[model samples]
Target chain A: MKEISFKNDILPLGDKLYRLALRITCNKQEAEDVVQDTLIKLWEGREKLKEVDNLTVYAMTVCRNQALDHNAKHENKNISLEDSGVDGFDNQHMPDERLIYNQRYEIINELINRMPEKQRTVIQLRDIEGRNYQEISLMMNISLADVKVTLFRARQQLKEQLKKQKNGL
Target chain B: MDYKYIEQLLERYWQCETTLEEEQILHSFFKQHDVPEHLQQYADLFSYESEAAQECLSDDFKQRMLDMVDEEPAVEAKTIKFVSRITPLFKAAAVVAIALTIGNVAERTMQDNSVGDNAGAPSIADTYTRTEDITATIHIIDRNQSESMAKADTVQVDDITRR
Candidate 1:
């Protein structure tokens, strides 16, 4: 087999790794930094990765660790909760609908941000990124059962919070 | 799409019993343009997941990383296998130490099992090899003996203790 190029085989994973980092770190700039560190670390360990069958998962695990490290050192203070969801939704709604959408989305984001880091990260991976439970478990360094339980708690909390909002309770 | 099945899946979902496929089905169901009015309230949450996935690193991220990668020392990327990291001398020493420890532990456990099980038989615990070369049966017999004995003791202890 031909040797894998860093730009082709490795760098293309940037977006996926960035999503994972952003999910873990919750700060875009720090997430970007984490992805950069993760990619560089992988490149340094490239010789070892040649034997790895699934580089994407390997890169994800690396990204997760770096993101968590960045999260600890930074305390996520760089995050402005207001700006997080601005780019999350497209501007296809009517002017009034857009305002309502922003309000509802901000509430949901606050609820999600208030969640324990593990539960929120699990929700992001499973719900937003559409990763399987096994992959989430590996990325989080937790068991499969733990992944499901965390996700269930996140979803249940989201449902309850959303329902309360709907009822204005 | 049948809304009833999706409702059931949503229920199972809240219960943490829904399979991944069922969860996907719920997302897809809510993705439809005209979600039934009753279910419309949930449309935002599921759609949020879909929309949020669109977030990606900026275009400049790749170039920044590539530049950083180029600046790093070329010698840093050397391939050092995990096994190769430890000197062969240390590896041999580790192998011997582990074997000796396992053998010693096995001897003690065998002695305990013999005393505990038969009361009359002395634990021989002599299945270990003295040379650096180790026999597989030595470990296997100890593990099997311990496992089966533990299982038997568990069943008996539970059966009689309640009475």
Candidate 2:
């Protein structure tokens, strides 16, 4: 593929890849590293780019695998969510609103992090990344039913966590 | 704003029956400030989802990534080709070195035995024993000097090197 075309077509998926990596690794620097590695791997395999039907899905798979590998390697180390910082949703809000938003974001992010990796990833792909079940299943290399089952569990767990948080649990 | 529709969607959301768009609608609905008293708690969670989705790498990161791609050697394929071509040469060189070393050792051993026979008396042990003793003495002297120097540097003579 032409370098210009590749960059134009493929690089825009970086944001989606970043979100997946962030959700998986739960740290900004590690997520960025994963995305960087994913992009480099994609570039290395650019010769086979034509065979890919959906570049976004392909790129996401690469990013997910790289993030998983990074998580595996650093499994024994404590992952700090502090590196995500109090930005993104912090701007344009009053102090009280910002605090509330941050608390809620933290709670939900933490709840998602608590879920098993497969469940969390499926939730991310289906809910946050807005991918369909078939697409997510394909990207995740799992069956459609497996994707649905995982997403079901993830949403159920998230709901339970949210309810518990509401009850001050 | 009325949240009856949102409340229903929220139920479906928990059941994993909502589509991505419907889920997005819930997030948008909850992002506003007009949720009823009973549903306020769920607002933060949905709004948080919207906000978390927006968390992404900075522009500086994007630029750095692009620069990295740019910095990658465009001749990577050529370099791989070159390495493949020279690999056989390296293997041949390694083999030749090993063969030469073995041949030299064998020739030296044969010459040594012949010389020993001609000389009629000097054993291999005799030839090695003097050098071994000299090395041992030198090592002992070096060790003693180092030990003394270490002790002089420190007021306490601790036997730290306990081998």
Candidate 3:
């Protein structure tokens, strides 16, 4: 069996993991943390990774899970604040009116960020990451059909947003 | 140059029917500044995809990760190996210490006896005192009498004559 070098084999997956995490978490710091945690996990379990068929996909899956967990915790924190009747707790996803008047790309970014986690991740993996449906399915642990469906919904959402942006413009 | 192909690809793209290559064609078509005004709205989405893929971790992140992985277990392994490697030597030292303690105790006891007795000097005096007691009890048996006693063994002729 060929030896797996962390620097060669695993570290290169950091950016992919970061993109997935950032797509899921919508925060750079949280995404970086998720990637760091995922890499450390892969390094710690490198001994058992020999049996893994696709280490890259496995790392992405782990990063995705960690990112989702962070998002869940963050939402829960926000929910708790809401429950406590905290006033002026601004919503992070709500874009200001000026951002709508800014570059079209920011609006697209905002729209992508507002989608469901599965849809956002599916778009990130399929379109941005250039991953096939099979690989996306494997990374997300979803069926192939589900990956396409999620991606279709995501793309359709973007189309609707583009239409709305055009009308607004 | 008809915009029909891109328009069709964009339609298929929205329907999730475009192949990856077809999608790349659309992305490339949109990247150019000559994008027809009618198809311009979709360009940002494709361009975003292209640019977002370029997003990467900072330069120091990889170094930080390497540092984290490299530092921890090495220190732990060094400490563990050092202890494991020297444990037997420690046990051997403990055994030698116990043996030396027991030897010191035994030697001290022996020395105490030797010092108190002055190396058998008191035993010689004790023997002399015992001999004197016996001489007084037997009233100074001469050498001839001792020889006669030895020859006669248990028969005491002197005692019989006195009787």
Candidate 4:
């Protein structure tokens, strides 16, 4: 309900926003840019946002739309989202354990990445980000029921996939 | 130790009936030292969930954003307020000032050349003298031609006579 300060409010959301955008766009750089653009856009539209509660969720919604729009426009690019620094995990300590950890995590990420866009985003927000169903529904602009349905499908798919590859681990 | 409660929560989790806190308890149980041998398969999912949440924008991202934000406002303000609103006024004033200066200087110079023959620029006297003034000066020079043939003078003779 107050003017959103970029430093106190929007800048701090960069990680959460980036994670959401990364979930939606599946590309780290694109996700990062989406967060940047979302911040700037919120600043530009601060006057309109004065009456809006929960600027972080508002910004997340805006960021998601931007990411979807970006994905749509560059649909032809077809660059593998994994190429956006899939090796971002730190590997200096516990080289052997870290290697194994990275491999399993990479597989996990790959499985998650292969999910449908909506399902993947729902999983990232609800499971990874620990956001509640109501907040995710609001951010995704979908009904609470739809959020549950999407998450259900995503969890089922992830369980089956992880089980199928259990021997390889 | 018994693990029936977590297993039930996991079942409820798959059914999408678990509350956020219950789901979190499931994640916490799986994240521990031992995830129970029978239920180990779900470890990666919840572990990955926790790990992936740690993914974040790069360190410099905040600095870059602040730089961009700070830089944009100063530039926009300058363009809108100074260049658009005030700069043109200064430019027009400058042009008007230069025009007035040139006009005033030229007017005074012309006045001096016309009103004061000897005081004005001597070059303008030859080019812009009236016909009567030229003729009168020529008569004076004719009367003094013999004495002035040497090209010496107490008075300022017209430069043309020496040439």
Highest lDDT scorer = 4
TM-score, candidate number 2 = 0.66
lDDT of 4 by residue, B34-152 (tens): 77877888898888888888888887999999877886556456656765787789999999999999999999998876767665546755773689888888888887996776556
Candidate 2: regions farther than 4 A off: A1-6, A78-94, B71-163
**Which sequence of candidate numbers ranks them by TM-score, best first?**
4, 2, 3, 1
Candidate 4 wrongly placed segments (more than 4 Å): A79-85, A89-94, A167-169, B72-163
lDDT of 3 by residue, B1-163 (tens): 7998888888999999988899889878877878778888888888878878888888899999888877755755797799999999999999999999999999999989788786665664575567668786576557668888787964676678878
Per-prediction TM-score, please?
0.65, 0.66, 0.66, 0.70
* Model 1 segments more than 4 A misplaced: A76-95, B70-163
How many backbone overlaps does candidate 2 show? 0
TM-score of chain A of 2: 0.87
Cα lDDT, model 4, residue A28: 77
Candidate lDDT (C-alpha), each: 0.77, 0.79, 0.81, 0.82
Candidate order by decreasing lDDT: 4, 3, 2, 1
Worst 10 residues of 2 chain B by lDDT: B154-163
Kindly list the interface RMSD, in angstroms, of each predicted candidate in the order they appear: 1.7, 1.5, 0.9, 0.9
What DockQ does predicted model 2 obtain? 0.37
Question: Residue A43, candidate 4: how far off, in angstroms?
Answer: 1.1
Model 2 residue B142 lDDT score: 100
Relative to the unseen true structure, what is the C-alpha lDDT of residue A168 in candidate 2, on a scale of 0 to 100? 88
Error of 1 at A107 (Å): 3.2
